[model samples]
Target: MIDKILNTRTILAVDDDPTNIHAVAGYLQPHGAKLLVANSGEKALEVLAQNIPDLIILDINMPGQSGIEVCRKIKQDTRLEQVPVLFLTGSVKDVSEAFAVGGVDYIVKPVRSEELLARVSTHIRLSQLVKSLDKANLLLESVNESLEMKVQERTLELVTVNKNLRIEIDERRRLQDKISYLSNYDFVTRMFNRNSMEQELKVVMETQSDADARSFLYYIDLDQFKIINDTCGHVAGDELLRQIAELLRGGFEFASICARMGGDEFAVLSQSLNLDDAIKRAHLIKDNIENHRFEWNEEVFKHSISMAVVEIDEGIDSVSHLLSIAERTCFESKRKGGGEVSIYNYSKDYIDKTQQQMKIIPLIHQAIEDNQFILYFQHICANNDSKLQKIEVLLRLQDESGKIKPPGHFIPVAERFHLITEIDKWVLKNTFKAISSLPENIIVSINLSGEFIIKSNAVELIRDLLLQHKVQPSRICFEITETSAISNIGATHRFMLELNETGCLFSLDDFGTGTSSYEYLKQLPVDFVKIDGMFVRDIENDEISRKMVESISGIARAKQIKVIAECVESEAALNIINNMGVDYYQGFVAHKPEPLMNLFTLVK
Candidate 1:
């Protein structure tokens, strides 16, 4: 039943018995299903609160809350009511109660593998079909209501068409003309469409006689167009785009062609003599749009645009290639804080940097395979008595030539290829093993990449390593950045919850940098909040930075999360943050990162 079309499914197994959970996982995982397990009904609810598993294999008779009670609670929740629940009960007596409590089906204990999978697949497919039909019914009802209202109007039109031949001919001609117009023009802006613009550009390139003759393709993309569409409605968004289209038409009269490429993107092919002329025209177009404002629902929006000019010369390849360069240039403009113009130069360092980064991807693979990644440790000092409470794990890549490389060079490249998960795992396994020889009081903190938390195997990998190293989970700390948690809150929540079971501490690393929402302290089971170094370093003078530190400390204190200020370079800054309620500090003012062998000196 798990076919190509259905893809992978997620199943949550709730049972106190380890054997039952194992059976459920064995049957499901092989068939491309993700398995989540909880030993109790309350723990199951905690999992369900964040994650919606496709099929739930619930146990009926448990110590505290039975499967029926769990099903009843799940059905009571509006978000989970639609989810199908399957009960695994020992007694036939529990079958009827299971159904009464909203169980889709039931499988008696001593489950046959084939039968369990069959029942699970059947309920999942049926649930999907039911949801699909419900959605289709709503759409079909709306369509039928509109068709019923149009029935009389259509009947009258048919009769009129039979009576009057001239009117019918005129209607047909009007429809044909409209179709012809639409084929070459945009429906929203009434400008040349992408297809027509390609033909026009081809014609221009073929007709050029002089060897020195050149044109510039100005590709423009509206900045923050989604914000306008979201704040205002799509209708208002379209109106603003149409207005921008009009402004472009009026502003760039000398331009050979003005076209609407697609959503929030426009283009103009200019036959200007030099790059300066093209740049000036691009600036004028940008200025014109900036000067104008569109109002909707009493809200005014000043839309800005990012545009790029690519020179079309004899060296240019084709229409597609030219367009690609133009698009890339425009993206660069947007990336540099939009509302600006960029000229594509093959000599620019961005292309070179990209090429260099591409080379590192393989290096990352080799490093992981060969164990070239090395570790360093920095002490997180308890400010009150200048005692080091823990050490933050730092990663470094040793190149083939035997020189140590900082994480800055290779970490970003690793993250770009989604290899940071493996790197984090490497860190955990090695960190746990290394710390095995250290004293238990020396808590070792490992920084987890955003990529690691979202992976399903993160918890399993950590658990196996912890067991292999025979390390106490309480002495191992996993540091997750605020940016990582906010990216996929549900996956992060589940990962943290599962990992928390091992008794490891969590620190919301780089605190003041992300969403800056203090609610994370409550949502995440974080034992510590490590304030971003940028804020901590400037807290001595900057009022806003000081306020941020104070607010974080005040709220985090209320939540009982200890605050650790990073990059505390000055005693003045440390004093300020210490007074502001920061429990721990990490910077040059206290302790610097050193080789793992020197970790013992941190606590000393």
Candidate 2:
């Protein structure tokens, strides 16, 4: 008698031999279980295709396909590999061989009913244990989610109460005829609360009516305030904000209103000022913010500030619109860097262009869904002979109206919205597709934004593209700006090496511009250097500019890397660079970046 009482469990029995299958099925049938039979390995696979069972009883030495082959196939499949396999073999040798192919256990037949039932029951019980573990893991995740939601609810209640207390304090000060001296002002250094400042701006805009009189609103945000907050704690963050507020108020005393807009942001409203005067005040405020040193617990901390100034004119229709324009202008300033100020001018095309871009963002998103963007290749040539060594794939957006818009008009907007990643993916797919049609040994390079490089999965997307296209990785190159490479060295280095491992190359573009370090040139995984257009444009006439290019070209040669002189227009600039041993060149003299169709005609 079997020691264990059999519980009902479904079992799938697979074999080509009908007598052997019947014998195994009959043994399991009496043990309070249902048996499913498949006549061959192919039929067993088909059974699994439709439904999964708790355990499989397989027979070895069947026709059409061996049990070992079926067992191996089952183990190889990710979905079926977890199901326990019990082999039905005629001999001990066959059972040993079956175990080699990932079978769990075996029963030798002409079968003893008791032994077969015992082994089947044990394997089924093991499979049940695994399913139980999975359910427990799911339950643990649900409990964690419930606890997180409760914590978030408590946090919101605290913030709401804090805001109410602040409003009451402001009201009490107003009753005491110390409305401007309210507790909303940080007494330690005299900066207003974010809530108070916003309220003040609303009052000023409502009270003033002269449209021609320019009212300047400056939004100031300190750079890297979080670093000080983390390093020196909330006390230090509070102290820094207080000190910054004092410096701003002192510097802009002539302004109509100076108020702290919470955290590290401050707002200044200057009334009845000309464009030049407003700009002068904006610069002075910026300089003061940069020069001011904050002392926290006896340690001096220095940081920069970014400012966005908007001059209220007749065109400004609403107070919200005025504030929104200032905020967006400030955002643009922050993107460029935090040490300067950007004044919102009504005449600037970027503002209207940005508004139009916002309107088209939804349309652009739809284009991505409908596969409307197309990739075009513009060749980057050898400057000396004008021979094409590589092509740079450029993206063009085709709208519903069948209009092709150049990247220059839309790429900046794409970068601003962080939508460049999707555009980058589309470029990689279409570029690789284009490569298959091009001649072998010709390299294709793609230009990527610093934002895309720093924030997205550029490497993974490119790797998948190369694999799908079956293109040689060596034929692909990625170009990044010199400024971007130096900005985040660690992240850029990791990305470069990851792609380099797959035989792709990297180029440090627009070299000799910005605050790029020459020391970084040797440290970076750079293959080609593209000289900035500024140097090339003036090199023909300016001795100083020509000398700079010569020096940069010499450095590139010493490192055994190629250099491409960009924007070379005149014969003299070309003659100078070729003599300096520049590896390649690009300019109007060689070729301008044209449409891919034009490039085909020009090259032919």
Candidate 3:
């Protein structure tokens, strides 16, 4: 009489008597089912908090908290209520109490094994069927709501038409034409959207002659438009986009095809332009955009665009492939600064970097899942002190072949895909565990991304880790890049201040590479400013580098903030920075990064 439905299901049996619990377990174990036993009603609730079983078998009597009370609590919780409860009552009076407390069915104690198996099987089968139907209903409702919204929009448009016979006839034809126009063009800028552009590209590819030279696809992205959009309203942003669309159409020749792919992005297709001519054309567009200013509410704002140009050759098989290459190259150009251009020529170096960027996403997922990421620490020395008083932690990924990949190779790609948040969490958890085992006074610094800094929950996660690992806040330091701080000043300030209050230190890394005004520098409550490595690398030989170092040091000194010099590769560079009144030195001259475990053996 047993069914296969109960074979794989789990059942939790709760009772005060060991003999009755063993009886239920002995009967259920032979059926190829799992039985979890709880000694009392209180113990049953603890097990239920962590696991939801297909069925709960409860004994009504002989416990401090009765089985009826446990059933009542389970029914009150919507997540646990869907689970069927089967009660075992020794008396007929308790059978009515079981039904009142939301038990699906009851069997009297001194129970027969055959009846126990039959009731458990029936309830488990029904619970699964109900869950399946609930999922189906949710999916159907989503589809219905989407369809209803579309119908309502169409109905509203139909109601606005005139009533005259002649006018109504013309209105229907006009509406059809309007629909066709919208299908191809963006409503706001009146340029071709992504879908329409692909259809046109396909037509051109089919009709073009084989003898003709390759055309060019220019992917243009507006820079700093987000800042303007966020500061001003969306209405102003729309006006700016419309103006840019008109500028693009007017700047290019009539033969060239122009389109707006989406928000703050536009593209142009040019035919028969040589590399030199294309470069000049790209520069012209850049210069025109830089000079133009938009006026809104008596305020003026300027914007620039970054562009990538790729050849539309026979090798490109689809629109997506061409756009992806152009977009990647465009991103590289934008990295240099605003109004920059990059050409995708399939050169070996460009191809290698692009390929690495493409592969990094999946590799990051694998690294995190397999726990293959590791930490290395580099020593930093304070002024005139040769000891390794502080160390900065660095992260590296290990491949399956046991080769370690540097952060430079993967960090940029990880940042682009928003995977940095997960990577940072992994680093914080592991690093805190490592730091806890080191000397109580040893300081370790970890880098955090801007995206993580902006999250409201990031501080809570860090605080919990610190408490769990038993690491002192003063022994840890957080390093953030200068540009990241300036990008979201309010959030960055709050993140730094909150942690600083807990005795954790903050450092402004890559200083002097961002804006030179130095006003925001005072607002950020950081303990140290690490001079950018580019300037520190040749401080002894280069006069400009020395002056830049001196100027940055003097400002930090004025604010009572310590300064750390990076890239101190040689004795001359180290001597120069030391004389410049820098408080700390970090580079090969001090000590290179090594695995935390290899550096020393600590009590774990």
- What are the candidates' C-alpha RMSDs? 17.4, 23.3, 20.8
| lDDT (Cα, tens digit) per residue for candidate 2, span 1-604 | 3224344566789976566777886777776666778988999988888767778988875655668888999999888888989887754334434755678667665666655765677667656655654564455456556545755777767666556545544554444444345336644457665445656766766676766666678888787786786677656777777777777778765546777654466788776458888888788878877777777778887888878878766577766576667766766677787786887874246666667877876666776778788776655666456434787777788888899988876777776655676677667677788676655557888887775576445677788888888888888889888887888888888888988999998888889985655787888888988888888897878888888788888898889878888788878888888887887777677665655555445444
What TM-score, computed on C-alpha atoms, does each candidate reach? 0.50, 0.52, 0.55
lDDT of 1 by residue, 1-604 (tens): 4553225787889987677888888877877788889999999999999999888899986645778889999999998898889998764434545755778667767666756865687778877866765565566556556555665567766554444544444554565576567568887899998778888878877776665546778888888786776676566778988998999899876546899876578889877767788788889888998889888899888878888888877666677667766766776787789987888874246644655786897788788779898888888888676433588889888998999999999988777645677688788878888889887777888899887777656788888888888998898888988998889888988988988888988999988776646777678889999888888888888999998888889888998998999999998998898788789989999777778967656435
- Native-structure RMSD, model 3: 20.8
lDDT of each: 0.79, 0.72, 0.80
Per-prediction backbone clash count: 0, 0, 0
Error of 1 at 403 (Å): 3.7
What overall lDDT, based on C-alpha atoms, would model 3 receive against the true structure? 0.80
Give the CA lDDT, 0 to 100, for residue 273 in model 3. Answer: 42
Better of 2 and 3 by lDDT: 3
**Cα deviation in Å at residue 318, candidate 2?**
2.3
How close to the true structure is residue 61 of candidate 3, measured as C-alpha lDDT?
A: 64
**Whose lDDT is greatest here?**
3
lDDT of 3 by residue, 115-153 (tens): 677668867876786676556456545645654575576
Worst 10 residues of 3 by lDDT: 157-166
